[model samples]
Target: MTDFYDRAAAREAEILSDALAAQQRRARNGLGAVSALACEDCGASIPEARRQAIHGVQRCVGCQTVQERLAR
Candidate 1:
Protein backbone atom coordinates (compact mmCIF):
# COMPACT_ATOMS: atom_id res chain seq x y z
CA MET A 1 0.00 0.00 0.00
CA THR A 2 2.80 2.41 0.88
CA ASP A 3 4.58 1.66 -2.41
CA PHE A 4 1.41 2.27 -4.38
CA TYR A 5 0.88 5.60 -2.69
CA ASP A 6 4.46 6.62 -3.44
CA ARG A 7 4.03 5.76 -7.09
CA ALA A 8 0.84 7.72 -7.28
CA ALA A 9 2.48 10.75 -5.70
CA ALA A 10 5.33 10.53 -8.18
CA ARG A 11 2.94 10.33 -11.06
CA GLU A 12 1.03 13.33 -9.83
CA ALA A 13 4.22 15.33 -9.48
CA GLU A 14 5.28 14.44 -13.02
CA ILE A 15 1.95 15.45 -14.43
CA LEU A 16 2.07 18.76 -12.61
CA SER A 17 5.55 19.43 -13.88
CA ASP A 18 4.58 18.63 -17.43
CA ALA A 19 1.55 20.88 -17.28
CA LEU A 20 3.65 23.76 -15.93
CA ALA A 21 6.24 23.29 -18.64
CA ALA A 22 3.60 23.22 -21.36
CA GLN A 23 2.06 26.42 -20.02
CA GLN A 24 5.42 28.14 -20.06
CA ARG A 25 6.10 27.06 -23.60
CA ARG A 26 2.73 28.31 -24.76
CA ALA A 27 3.30 31.65 -23.07
CA ARG A 28 6.68 32.06 -24.76
CA ASN A 29 5.33 31.13 -28.16
CA GLY A 30 2.40 33.49 -27.74
CA LEU A 31 4.77 36.31 -26.78
CA GLY A 32 7.02 35.62 -29.72
CA ALA A 33 4.10 36.14 -32.09
CA VAL A 34 3.11 39.49 -30.58
CA SER A 35 4.26 42.45 -32.67
CA ALA A 36 5.34 45.61 -30.88
CA LEU A 37 4.27 48.13 -33.45
CA ALA A 38 1.64 50.02 -31.44
CA CYS A 39 -0.37 49.87 -28.26
CA GLU A 40 -3.77 48.29 -28.87
CA ASP A 41 -5.48 50.63 -26.44
CA CYS A 42 -3.86 54.06 -26.96
CA GLY A 43 -2.19 53.62 -30.35
CA ALA A 44 1.11 54.82 -28.87
CA SER A 45 4.31 53.40 -30.19
CA ILE A 46 5.53 50.64 -27.89
CA PRO A 47 9.13 51.07 -26.83
CA GLU A 48 11.58 48.43 -27.96
CA ALA A 49 12.76 47.77 -24.43
CA ARG A 50 9.24 47.43 -23.12
CA ARG A 51 8.33 45.07 -25.89
CA GLN A 52 11.36 42.93 -25.24
CA ALA A 53 10.80 42.86 -21.50
CA ILE A 54 7.16 41.83 -21.66
CA HIS A 55 6.04 38.92 -23.75
CA GLY A 56 2.76 39.44 -25.68
CA VAL A 57 2.11 42.91 -24.37
CA GLN A 58 -0.66 44.77 -26.21
CA ARG A 59 -0.75 48.01 -24.26
CA CYS A 60 1.71 50.80 -23.45
CA VAL A 61 2.86 51.26 -19.87
CA GLY A 62 0.50 54.12 -19.08
CA CYS A 63 -2.46 52.43 -20.64
CA GLN A 64 -1.67 49.14 -18.96
CA THR A 65 -1.50 50.83 -15.57
CA VAL A 66 -4.88 52.39 -16.07
CA GLN A 67 -6.31 49.12 -17.22
CA GLU A 68 -5.04 47.30 -14.15
CA ARG A 69 -6.42 49.93 -11.85
CA LEU A 70 -9.82 49.80 -13.49
CA ALA A 71 -9.88 46.02 -13.23
CA ARG A 72 -9.67 46.33 -9.48
Candidate 2:
Protein backbone atom coordinates (compact mmCIF):
# COMPACT_ATOMS: atom_id res chain seq x y z
CA MET A 1 0.00 0.00 0.00
CA THR A 2 1.13 3.54 -0.70
CA ASP A 3 2.00 5.69 2.27
CA PHE A 4 0.05 8.94 2.26
CA TYR A 5 2.24 10.40 4.98
CA ASP A 6 5.31 10.01 2.84
CA ARG A 7 3.67 11.84 -0.04
CA ALA A 8 2.69 14.73 2.21
CA ALA A 9 6.21 15.04 3.56
CA ALA A 10 7.61 15.16 0.05
CA ARG A 11 5.23 17.92 -0.94
CA GLU A 12 6.10 19.94 2.17
CA ALA A 13 9.79 19.65 1.45
CA GLU A 14 9.33 20.87 -2.11
CA ILE A 15 7.37 23.90 -0.96
CA LEU A 16 9.95 24.79 1.64
CA SER A 17 12.77 24.49 -0.87
CA ASP A 18 11.02 26.78 -3.34
CA ALA A 19 10.38 29.38 -0.66
CA LEU A 20 14.01 29.33 0.40
CA ALA A 21 15.20 29.84 -3.16
CA ALA A 22 12.90 32.83 -3.58
CA GLN A 23 14.22 34.40 -0.39
CA GLN A 24 17.80 33.96 -1.55
CA ARG A 25 16.99 35.70 -4.80
CA ARG A 26 15.47 38.62 -2.95
CA ALA A 27 18.45 38.92 -0.65
CA ARG A 28 20.72 38.95 -3.65
CA ASN A 29 18.89 41.61 -5.68
CA GLY A 30 16.36 43.45 -3.53
CA LEU A 31 18.22 46.46 -2.18
CA GLY A 32 19.53 48.04 -5.33
CA ALA A 33 19.42 51.69 -4.19
CA VAL A 34 21.57 51.32 -1.12
CA SER A 35 24.72 53.05 -2.22
CA ALA A 36 25.31 54.92 1.04
CA LEU A 37 25.40 54.17 4.76
CA ALA A 38 22.03 55.73 5.56
CA CYS A 39 18.49 54.46 5.81
CA GLU A 40 16.37 55.52 2.87
CA ASP A 41 13.29 55.52 5.07
CA CYS A 42 14.40 56.92 8.49
CA GLY A 43 17.93 58.08 7.70
CA ALA A 44 19.25 55.84 10.42
CA SER A 45 22.86 54.77 10.27
CA ILE A 46 23.42 51.70 8.11
CA PRO A 47 26.77 50.39 9.08
CA GLU A 48 29.49 49.50 6.59
CA ALA A 49 29.65 46.02 8.04
CA ARG A 50 25.95 45.48 7.42
CA ARG A 51 26.18 46.64 3.83
CA GLN A 52 29.01 44.24 3.21
CA ALA A 53 27.17 41.40 4.92
CA ILE A 54 23.83 41.81 3.15
CA HIS A 55 24.97 42.60 -0.38
CA GLY A 56 22.84 45.73 -0.96
CA VAL A 57 21.14 46.41 2.34
CA GLN A 58 19.74 49.89 2.97
CA ARG A 59 17.62 50.00 6.12
CA CYS A 60 18.89 48.71 9.43
CA VAL A 61 17.94 45.25 10.66
CA GLY A 62 14.96 46.48 12.67
CA CYS A 63 13.40 48.28 9.73
CA GLN A 64 14.12 45.40 7.40
CA THR A 65 12.43 42.90 9.70
CA VAL A 66 9.34 45.06 10.06
CA GLN A 67 9.03 45.46 6.33
CA GLU A 68 9.43 41.72 5.77
CA ARG A 69 6.78 40.94 8.39
CA LEU A 70 4.30 43.28 6.79
CA ALA A 71 5.07 41.76 3.42
CA ARG A 72 4.04 38.37 4.71
Best by TM-score: 2
In Å, residue 62's CA in model 1 sits off its true spot by: 0.5
Candidate with maximal lDDT: 1
The segments of candidate 1 whose C-alpha lies over 4 angstroms from its true place after superposition are 1-30
Give a tens-digit lDDT track for model 2, residues 1-72. 559998999999999999999998887685564555888778899988888777667688888888899999
Cα lDDT listed for each candidate: 0.89, 0.81
What TM-score goes with each of the models?
A: 0.55, 0.69
* Residue 49 of model 1, lDDT score: 91
lDDT of 1 by residue, 1-72 (tens): 579889999999999999999999988787767756799998999999988888788899999999999999
Write down the lDDT that model 1 would get. 0.89
